[model samples]
Target: MTSIAPPRLPEPAPAGAAPPTSAPVLRMRGVTRVHGGGATQVVALRGLDLVVYPGELVAVMGPSGSGKSTLLTLAGGLDVATSGEVFVDGTALGRLSTKALAALRRRSLGYVFQDLNLVPALTAAENVALPRELDGVATRKAYREAVAALTEVGVAELADRFPDQMSGGQQQRVAIARALVGPRRLVLADEPTGALDSATSGEVMRVLRARCDAGAAGLLVTHEARHAGWADRVVFLRDGMVVDSTGEPSTPESLLDGDGGSTAGGAER
Candidate 1:
């Protein structure tokens, strides 16, 4: 009898396909977002200063309406701030035109919205390949990359399944695979596990941590304490500013202080 061969595995891209040296991948200084103008205006961000190094996973937390969303939008170039500067890989966001900003986000940033943002009509592999397709890559090449990404996230078997057929965790993994499929450097996730239960949320956070270990910089906006435990650091936002970075160096506990402890790196501390 003839022996059967083992199934093939997806391999990582060659070194030439990698991004540049790990520098300060994202930076923001004196960033401010003001809603309305003159007397009717309300300040959202007040001179916020932030930096996310490569291969780091920073967790941002705050109460509702604390300008966390504003900070995230401004950082990701989705929404512009009225004052200060936002930089991705040393290029100033304020200096770029709207079109330039769009291009920058497309090539460098990967975003995971709470909704997962999968195309309802497409299979998981197709959904993951959407970005590459938008960038004019051939369908076959994009699909291959998408499969590799899904395999990395341990969801390759779902490649042919539609979104409606998967669980919330599986859908979120698909979203992550999509975010990581292209030459993306910064992964910005907004409540990525909000829809899952505690157990599934833990699994999702584990995948994100593994991604950071594999050289992707991630910024997560989450309110869940369990999820916050996986971050390298936590930047608590309040009234549009970084109220604290309480974690000790890179230790897990230093990054997370729940139930509202004292601020770590504020004016007083």
Candidate 2:
């Protein structure tokens, strides 16, 4: 891997934000997300507890409506928890004003959505540089950072290509570079491989694994067991709660051989 400069610190973290040396990048305690009201109420998550430390990649797996997406939304500060607290870098999310929360996200977080939302009108490099520009980085510096990030993901040559000119896998890589550019230390990916073939999915997973190995914390929500294999740990969710967890990193072969086969609230070795 080519050496890239460390992320430049953004303006001082908002008041109440934890210092960068804090251990866990993300922490959720007794979080719950509810939808609607009255008889139409629906509980998307129920008292979920999750913690992701630096240099770790945790994969979340579950069937549809298992609250996997909901978890990402809450963790990224996109949605508020109905109850309980969510702390990113040790600062309580609910305590921040909208402006402070936005600043935190801009400086410390990266999110890759299932749809791989790249700006259609922008070239790959421009797309990747958008976040840094939004954070007030100089155009030249942000473009340089974009190229470095694209190179890190093996897509530097695609920097000038538009989304329409790239393959789905290529576009996905660009989205990742966009998320990874600058000094962000935490990434949350929700079904990032949904549009790719098994082979391309593996490629994307490899990039995510590499990022985590390089010291960024990652939270990946994936439906494919094989895709989950790249994570350091697997968390299985059922009805908005964690049902089982894997203690060791699983391989594609082991994940395909059997269901992790743990009863509720147990760890699968």
The number of the candidate with the highest lDDT is 2
Candidate 2, residues 211-248, lDDT tens digits: the string is 88777888999888898887777889988888887753
Q: Across residues 71-150, which tens digit of lDDT does each residue of candidate 1 receive? A: 88888999888999888988998889988888888778988888787899999999999888887889999999999989
C-alpha lDDT values of all predictions: 0.79, 0.82
The TM-score of predicted model 2 comes to 0.83
Off by over 4 Å in 2: 1-22, 248-269
Score candidate 1 by lDDT.
0.79
